[model samples]
Target: MKQRIAWITDSTAVVPDELREKYDIHVVPLDVIFEDGAYADGIQLSSSELYEKIDHSKTVPKTSQPAIGKFVELYEQLAEDYDCAIAIHLSSQLSGTYNTSKSAAAMSEFPVEFVDSQIVSYPITTLLLKGISLAEQGMDYREIAATLREEASKNENYIVIGKLSQLHKGGRLSNAQLIVGTLLQIKPIFCIRNGVVELFEKVRTEGKAFRRIMDQLDLARGIHKISQVEILHGNVMDKALELKETIKSKYQDIEVLVYPLSPVLGVHGGQGTIALTWTNEPKSS
Candidate 1:
């Protein structure tokens, strides 16, 4: 008999509602905490609402991973139907969601395979989509999990910080760096390296920063065949659309998508921030 597998991911992964419904993909939401209280990332607080709150508030919000009990409850429920589950989450270095899910899986009677995507946003979406396709092709749960773990490292992202103060508040930047960057009007470009966000370069203006990102894309194309490009923004749809158009004009063969970043991500990236994420085609052994 074919093994029944359940697909699970965190809200940080941008799985469209229709696709999630079609694949029966389950999503566990993270918490976005404001001064007053905490709200579920995509459920209790929409991205637009979160941004609106940020605009009117004096303090930036923080994010928290889902409780281990929540995952345990989910696993117990899935155990009734599915033979096993594959849980994919954002980087372990970035969030405690992966560790929380692992602990929950260990306590449950059901079998759960976890994939630490080592990245976030659209790249995680691409990995989940690929895993779904692999499962549809008759791959077992273990094979699909292993394939996703390997493919996870082949993705890359470049984020352009919109507000320097937000990074400083998140503890990603020092006060000295923030003060200097603010004085110099520097736009810092960051990338995920070894599962942690790191500064890639600093430019004087957003225009120059975008150019640098495109240049990196060009170099990446030479090294690996890119499958998809996603432009994610924090309440900046116009800029994301423009960047999408530019990428489409250059790489007509590659698929491109544009959408708002989740509220949890927006809390860190801040309003007006934009990111470019792409996945490379897997290499043959």
Candidate 2:
């Protein structure tokens, strides 16, 4: 009999449900808490429901990583049937999920290989799906983890925010800064580096921000292999689809996925947030 590998990731990953089901991937959800109550992401709270609450709530919703106990419970269960499990999670710099996952792996009786994707949403989901494919092809856990780490190093996440108020309310930005930026209608463009958010540019108008993001994609197209592309949005599906069409017009061969940003992320990203992510083709000397 062939040994089975259990694939796992957090809810922050933007992998589609159908793919998750097909891959037999286990997703441990994070919590999105409102004044009324706390709800498990994707389980009790959906992106649409959570956004509706965000639209009307007096206070902004907060996100929390799953407890260590939850991970322990999952690892124990996976140990029952699978030979081992590989658990990939969001960046440690972005959240404590990677650390929490590591702690749980230590507590598990069976092997649970933990990885810090150093990226979020669609980029992380891309790595998870790739790893799952490798696992299904009979690759060992360590080999799959190593390959993903290498790929993640060459990946990029470019996010464009429609507003900075959510970042302020979430404490990612200071109130004064938010006021200044919003008063001026600033569209913030940022990228993830080494698992931390780094500002790439700040433009005055939405048009410039989108153009800048596309320019970066163009530059990436010049230098990388361009294996995958993802279009992520908080609530702006129309705009996301438009961007997808633009990308398709330029790069017709690459695999493209349109994913909705999770509610946990929407709390800080706010509505109209759109992100583009892709992995670079490995460079050869």
Best by lDDT: 1
Residue 159, candidate 1: Cα error in Å is 0.6
lDDT of 2 by residue, 1-285 (tens): 555888889999876779878888898999999999899988899888887887788778889999999999988888888998888888889889889888888887678777788988877777887887787787888899888888778887799995576677667788789888878889989889998889899998787888899999889888877867888898899999998888888889877788888988888788889999888885565
Q: Count of backbone clashes for each model?
A: 0, 1
Q: Candidate 1 — number of clashing residue pairs?
A: 0
Give the 10-residue window scoring lowest on summed lDDT in candidate 2: 162-171
Candidate 2 residue pairs that clash: 225-281
TM for every model, in the order presented, reads 0.95, 0.94
Give the local distance difference test score of model 2.
Answer: 0.85
Would you give me the overall lDDT of model 1? 0.90
Model 1 quality (TM-score): 0.95
Candidate 2 Cα outliers beyond 4 Å, as residue runs: 171-176, 283-285
**lDDT agreement with native, every candidate:** 0.90, 0.85
